[model samples]
Target: MTERPNMETRTILRVIVCDNDIRKIVLPLKPQTVDSLLEQLEEKLGLQYKFTLQFEDPDFNNSLVNLTDIADLPDKPTLKIVSLVTTPTPSTADTEILSVASDDPCHSLRTAWPETFEIPNFPVDVEYRLRQGNLQYMRDQTYLQLSGELKHEILEKLSETIYSYKAYPNKEDFEAVAAALIKKHPCLTQPGSSKGWNGWYDSLRWKMGNYRSKLRRAGCLEVSINGGKRRGQQPQRNVKRPKRFEINFLPNFPDGEDEASMESKRKEMVEEMKKRRLNSALIAQNMNSTFALRRKELIEKEPAVKNTVERWPALFTNGQKSNVNARRTAVLHGLPLLLGEDPTDFYKTCFDCDSNEDMLDTAIGIMTVIPEDSPTVPYSLHLDATTTAIILEGTVVVDNLENVPQAMCLLFGLIYALNLEYPAALKSTFDFLQRVILSLGHKSLKPKIQSLKKSPNAVMFFHG
Candidate 1:
């Protein structure tokens, strides 16, 4: 007779395939080799052809890195069933060579992120906790509440994986990792966010920062140059970090030049803008050449809006593209957050803007609800069914806009371009766009922004 498996560690897992087309019945679980698991799955799920069963590796921010090995097929791990016949992604190829470098994830000579990466297996204790979490999730629907230790393990692994790609991941990149984590394991979804992973997003962001700091201290060249002391002239301002979808967040000064030469080029471009009118292509060319220099002024100098405009007037004037000018706004305005109400509760009314005139009409009510008796900036949008224009300080700043949405977008850029204050009544809504979305303004979040980003029940405040 064959040797009996240990009864103490014995677990019976029943597989439930949600798709009816697959012709599934309950499948019995037997932990052994990868081949055994495949054999069991093929019969029960009625998979007719060759396929790969990829497990979700919690180590690499729940990325589908579990391609092969019995080591990858941990007990109760999350699974991804991919058909072998499908076209492969760049990250899915089974090359013996690693796409990302093993020794130095950062400081690579490559211009872009690696298409594929593989993380090391999780520690035994971390794997045990993950198995327990998956088991509990299977029993009921309770999401895993990660303790401090487990959380740190996931963060550290993810930070290394991200460094293999890019050292400075912007807001969208951070969201992508957090989203993938929850997508792979619904159990790991933090309770707070409607997105279910906003907390993870925040955690990963901080973890990347801390990880970079540690690397910098250990003489990692990629992160070492980014230290505050090494940054140029203005020392008291924010450290230069990636603001948007930047490929090189903090590139060195173009080989042959220094700060004074860049300053000369910037001046030449300012004069060139006047000669070529506001619509010159040279404006962009110069701007591109001086990107590193511009970052220093923006990050180190921390100039005021008017000061920024004085450096380049053409910059603000060139920002009125029709698509970029406007976006679809909500039927609901900022009244919900201003009144301390949960905005998601009004999703029905908020999204239905077909016949809604809330954006135009809401301004009149904003004055009444604000703590101060008087209105700020003479705020309102004028729409007589022909065209809409934003009225700021009793002056129609720009006219012939397509809709209120475009007007709002144009007005927002103007607020920065012209160095204007956000109207007091809608300050929270405006602040949400600046501090939360764009990552502008003070480093420490204000109360309203904190409420929007961190408060579990508080969805983002909007303006429409």
Candidate 2:
């Protein structure tokens, strides 16, 4: 029998998995388009009803990226497959340096903001002018009224920051913020109005809501999810969010992982935990590598906490508990000065004002918590300047943190690592830091950080 010459056009590839259990297929012809390739994959992978497709690219250090264009496929490329429904949404410090996205594409947007009206800090030049503006207002009764350009620039950064937390802002959410803004700066109050900030409050309330409405109408899913469903409506409660700052909360299975591959890693972790001479390194690696699968169990099955702990006991260990994703710390050291607005400096710059010496030295009663579970523990986040230790409800858990940034970073990390929610007061601050600066866990920033990615010089910062 003679083979047809047309058969030479065929292509072969191996689905990314362990070498021992690789799934390989030869295509009769190279798929001419991305959709065609996806169709072929869907038909061949027996149990996969729906899937996401990624391929190794030498262009991205052999890291996998979504297969957007079939022509982008390299000859005989390896493909990583995962169910589309299970793309896990969402870091570590120095032992693993997060590479910057310098090689990734960057784009710009017209404006952005933080979720709250408590602006972290204005641009350095803006701050200076604001100070000057305040001094002048002392003699005359005028708030630090900004020029049209200055206001837009300021609000642009604020919009990016706000979008990180939520696309919508209501009166209850931002009114107090306006009051506090004028209170602190004094220069920012409008003299004509009895309350002093009617105009600013209106700007926040209407502007943020309008932005989402416009985007939703324009079918901008980035602001409104999927740009489908009803636009600009409040979501029913119980939308699943990262319990903490979980980076790999709902992530795609790792580059070459599926049920079997991940299960094997899980077993290996269990076996390693059994060993008297535990391999901490190997256990950590496996723990991190299996995050997507762990989340899949938690998200889809909604398993009892006890059942999960028994199956993966090692995961409940203190070491593993503290080892949650450090994605928010991703390239944190590389974070730009951001128009002289250092994101890390929020705590120091936060209360450095006309307050008495005691207020500046120690910020008492800043945070409080009443757990849903019984035995309500006191919720207090107090900073003792002299000892430089953080006291949470009468006990000192963290000590000698030395400075505010280190303490703040550790506190933020602990919140995520422990799967704790942000204190209601500081929720916006946490979201901005998580979604904007450091750029850790969670899917769909909703940066695009206000961002270093969003613009040449704008980043959001908030302090509680």
Candidate 3:
């Protein structure tokens, strides 16, 4: 299937405040209509600057509205606003609708907080106390009321789940928890069957809707996960080989002037220069480097590689030496070897990209590259804020045989960078480190590395 390009779309205007205490605008506005909006915005911003509009709609194909197209917006004019986020009117539909018994418990809790607590005369006694006639002795009897305990409990649980998702934001994990809750505690999880409160079941539904909405609004929410079981059938395995387009060069290049051209010309050269076969082309999209070369290297030293394999047969096992060898192989093959140039920078890129796999990989590679080093490796590698640098104190786990060589190569690069001051060496070490981390999963390694790099005492860890 042909991939759809990002579409142009509009979103609700959200006002943001920057560190400079200046108000800034983020958009999900229409291409043409937003131009008019920006006219109003520039007047509001009181500055002459270019702006970008990102598409906020998840369902839409393209969602960017560039503000560069706008002509002259008034410098400073009366800013008439349709939506000002004040304390919302108490009677607004959202407020009124949310205040009802059918609304989310969190919303309800906010609206009718301490409903019972505010009334001092109301009974705080349990059912057992009431049955024992404990209140009979009271000279002034007050109306007995049950606690909103059930409502509060359900709300707390739902809030916990949503919060957990926000922190980690894994759809599969979130859905699994949601599903488990429903299966095990149907009263609380089901739409309208919870016991105790007047509209207990309805409240659950509201919580579900509310939580889902909050997550969706956050923008990183997964649509498939929100749809429950209605999501389509599981995607089929992608076994079809990507179609390779051939380009025929001019006749003069038949023998190919250079070794590179000659290699291209030799149809039989395909056999000699074995192409690195990616697990899937998609893997290439995020991989910092190619596994093809690494695989090729393994194939090349069938004899020497075989000897090493035989001598250190344990390298194939889960051992430090094995891990080192595996990492070396990965580096030789061309997988990235570093966490990134600057942990913070790469992190922001990843976060801004919203975890777009391809962009994230590129960002990670860019951010982790040792900056002082150039030519050998370029500086200013991209990364996001969430990127971390791990300081492995003891042993590191090797997930596969391939990781062994890759780890060894990474260790060597790290050692080389440690004693040396070459910018290129640092870049190479960072690249090597990143590839090693990538094998486990990008999310796992980013945090550790990021923390160390950001610290003022970043030098101490080298010896540790």
lDDT for each residue of candidate 1 in 208-242, tens digit (9 for 90 to 100): 98998898787654466567664454333345554
- Residue 143 displacement (Å), model 2: 3.7
Clashes of each: 0, 28, 66
Q: Is candidate 1 or candidate 3 better by lDDT?
A: 1
Better of 1 and 2 by TM-score: 2
- At residue 312, candidate 1 shows an lDDT of 57
- What TM-score quantifies how close candidate 3 is to the native fold? 0.16
Estimate, for each residue in 1-464, the C-alpha lDDT of model 2 and write its tens digit. 97654666888987742211247888787788878887887676543335667776667445445688888988888886644432221112211212112211111111222333456577888888977888888878665657887776666555555544344444554676677677777887776787887877888776676665665565442343323335675663333543332222333344456879989989888887787766554555566557657766776667798999866777676554322222222222124223223222122111222232322433221212122332211011122233234434334457655444465677776666767666453444555567665567774653423444454322422221
What lDDT would each prediction earn against the true structure? Answer: 0.52, 0.51, 0.30
Ranking by TM-score: 2, 1, 3
Error of 1 at 118 (Å): 9.1
* Error in Å for residue 1 of model 1: 78
As for lDDT, the candidate ahead, 1 or 2, is 1
The C-alpha RMSD in Å for every predicted model, in order, reads 24.1, 19.5, 24.7
Which candidate comes out best when scored by lDDT?
A: 1
The best candidate in terms of TM-score? 2
TM-score of each predicted structure versus truth: 0.30, 0.34, 0.16
